[model samples]
Target: MSTRHAVRDDLDSRPWTGPTRRYDILKEGAIALAIVAVLTFGLSALFSSPDEPALTFKGWSQSAPDNMYATMVAEMSGSSETAGYGPPYNVNSDGLSIGPLALQKWFGVTHPIDAAQDFVIAPLQSQQQPDAVTAAVSQWTSASADQRTAWATAYEDALNDPAGANGDATKVPAGDYGPVPTLAAAVVAMASSGAYDGALASAGGHFFNTDNTKQTMLMGDGSYMDDLATAGNLQGNTWGMVNETGSWPGQQWLATYSFWYQLPMFNNEDPNNTVATVLTDNADAIIFAIMFVVILLFVFLPFIPGLRSIPRWIPIQRLVWRQYYREYGKR
Candidate 1:
């Protein structure tokens, strides 16, 4: 063997005989865990927001009845965003796709949702209503699909009109709307009285309901929750995705993920246009794809060509073991 190789092999075989101290690993670990727990509890109690009341459909409807009524109309008409969303809901349109890969469709409609039936019709059917409301529900259910669509369209247009109801179903002008106006009014009343919330909660057919999917979907169909989100600075542009509802620290580590959204390249030029980037309407998918690659790069950093040399170049280990080096050099 060469002199250098012989020396290296000798060094490798050498055992440590330096000054040492007894270490009780278990005791050290227990002490560390106690300190960490105390610090965690202290910091969390000091910084975390108090538990706030959960936002409910009843609270939403009561606070913004006009918006709620408009949302109800949209749900009934099957024109809401959720209604048009395909795959897991219904195949109204192919949902946000990643290039040619229709991941949403491939998964299939695991959680089938019909906006009109689930949000409006079913809830109304389950509720106790007046004679007129009952007649309206019967008329709506018995009508042909085309007739129902026409009635919903006409009523929606009237609601949109500034001179008409303008979101207030009670003030909508008379038209060939069938029993839509009556049904809309009944929904508004039910929502106002908090019965609609109960009806949606029990949609899963359980005495003690836990499924909140229907309730959440119904809320998403409205601008009420959106308004609240905006007010709380929880909008995506505001990095709300990583934020808490009140004055509390959020997922700081997720700041990297949220950074991609702030870029102009990913931002939509027009609010009317759903296509945010060249990825079309799938900005979320594109962002996720980018993040996935970023994560992979991080995971395989040591295997990457130039990246693998970074540790050698920076030599942070020198600083970490400076005391050991000092003691060795003294010898």
Candidate 2:
């Protein structure tokens, strides 16, 4: 060989036969598409989409009228979760915090909710009830705030510990509960008959009150929805946000966002037994603040000092590019 050709030249060192063959690109594309479509159809037929039916007030009221009534009574007395919940709902809201931050209070009241008046009284007043219910409503609306609370408190006690009638508004004793018992029980009956749901749906925003914010809260304040969710292993601590309804895969990507709920501080039990209302409400605000931090971190990851250097430090790039090195690396 000549001295010039004998030199180790990268361009000259590689070998090529210049061989060629006709490839049916269109045919292969069609075959691939058909295979994917068939696999998709078969899988869909074998296992349909996982869709749990929505829990509605109508269903809840019909299933557990007593429980629903009890929940409403608690709400009326300002003892329910919704009543005490912070801004955008009502004042004197509690436990909305993350370290020194009070996000709920800071966010202020955007969508206020008067649990008793909004959930029960408003719905009852929306429809034409019996003469007795009408009388009770009259007294209730005209009564002073203290008088209203007194009546509601008495009814709540009676419902909890019945003297003559059963709790859950089935029947009531001839106690000083007055029109409170009558009104509350009538509300329960209205709910059970599925009238209350429609009333609630139309209560807040006039003819087009399609938003279910208040309705969902009414159920959430009670144990029914939480209990049902718990049964389905959908509690925050259960990693339920990422888990499926059945033993199947779900939105596992949400694990990062839902992880805070599983934390010890956020997962504490309601020692007061008021239930998930207060805790979940507060946890939601706090988790949102933390999630904001997480999102900021993610968005700025590439710009962050040490964080952006992770790929360079780890050097998995070598492994990723190993095949290219073996095929086309310099001698």
Candidate 3:
């Protein structure tokens, strides 16, 4: 007989003569269950998720009223990031693309946010305001688009000038801002009183008012959210993806996803570099594609030819069965 056939026949005829221990599967399962339960409850209580209070427009306005005012003006001027975000919002500019795919644009404007009206005008219109504030809103809505842009542009420039008021809304240099300042001031007042949060949330006229898109977008336009994120060390550059707020362990499973962002091409820190810019622009799509391929490879690893043979070639199993090998000699 060939060596392989002889070995298989010998193994088939062989009888075991080794020490054995009694195993009660039911007892073993119960012990395992008790241990797992204790650990689950103990660890969960010890490392519960952070319970920070939800951020509010009222809080933001109270903390940084001047920043809020500038954000409102930016929205009205159609200069805010959301205003030109393009696709899934508006088409003012084309969003990130992968090669010639224009993947973001293909999705189209699903949410359809008119930054000026939705973030600033709509919320204000929903709430009761002074006659001057109402008139300012009317003036804004009635003015030509160019007129509104010009007014907002002039006000934003003045608001941003550090040597001037340095973003202090009340002290901005005098200009032909028309009624924009009045409208902005009204929104600030709303935010300070906490009524602005309700106004934006209930803008859809729903009693439940669960959707917070408009409120979040408005807050995102200001610096307050970014400030909070930086303070918590939750910025993407800080490896925030796997980090929970405070000292708690975050989602470690996202390590693979966050790992790519640490690389230069994906970081977007150097915007002037052509390659970095291209990669950053398409980072989302590219990362997703890479992850998909990685997942496929992982799932098919057992079926791959050379890869599947690695376990056998490495022969780590010999270590596991060392006692048997010592007794019977290497098979």
Candidate 4:
């Protein structure tokens, strides 16, 4: 009877004393919701929407028509990040990988497209009364590779000389230069006239709904891209391209890859740029993925074996249930 009374006295001395009305579930939920709403609105107002640059071919053409060829060449040179961007663009190029694996090429030229013709020539051909431009393009098509190279080389050289503020390219000196300049001029004129986008519309006896190909090609041109890079401070030293006219964050995720270009290893290495870019991108992707997985595991580590026992080992449990220990003694 005395032992029973002692045990009852110990239980009475303990602190918990069953469920207390300390917390109101509804009140806590309302507070959490209010905090979340305030944060969401604040972030929305502070950061705002993502920046979208007004970089249309028409705008570029109107602004700098003389640099069309330089623009075209740049468009041709850069890697088409969207070429095989998959679904909602081109079905064939979708989901195919390219690199050492060559999955894209092995898939057999799916969505077979001639970047030059599709992006440049086709748009010009669609313009009203495009006979002269059409004739020049036809001549270019019939011309030999040497002849085309000669024209391009000559025109490219001619562009080096400065012209008036109106952006008129100096005429090429008399030579065996084919109809490339004339064709290129027509494209410039179309762009200048603000009909470039309208010409891009595939409404004339052909299916040309997809504008991605043309836009991609247009963005690749070196001179145009250089202009844009300059405007946006995307050049190597300034960092990868950002939206030229806005405060939004640029490609922050590519900070590492951008940093690699700053190193001496990639600097002054033009010929190896493609290979280096591909290798660096692949390596970075793998490393990031591994690190992400490691972080996730670390976050949930408390539930893992050999880790859950840490709480007990550290005597934190003893501190938490000190009243129970005082009455019942240590386990």
- For lDDT, the strongest prediction is 3
TM-score of each: 0.86, 0.78, 0.87, 0.58
Which scores higher on TM-score, 3 or 4?
3
Is candidate 1 or 2 superior in lDDT? 1
lDDT of 3 by residue, 17-58 (tens): 555558899999999999999999998998876888889999
TM-score (C-alpha, index-matched) for candidate 4 = 0.58
lDDT of 1 at 157: 92
The deviation in Å at residue 290 for candidate 2 is: 2.5
Model 1, C-alpha of 187: deviation from truth (Å):
1.4
lDDT of 1 at 174: 86
The residue pairs that clash in candidate 2, if any, are 88-109, 88-111, 89-113
State the lDDT of candidate 4 residue by residue for 1-331, as single tens digits.
Answer: 6998898768878886654447799999999999999998998999887665757677777666656655543222222333334333344343423334434344554454554565566776676646777788788778776666667656555544455222335554555556756766777677777787666655344574764555554555536656776776767655664323456667676665466555544444465677655544444344445456656767988768877668858987788889867977764
Worst 10 residues of 3 by lDDT: 12-21
Question: How many residue pairs collide in each prediction?
Answer: 0, 3, 0, 6
| CA RMSD, predictions in order | 3.7, 7.5, 4.1, 9.3
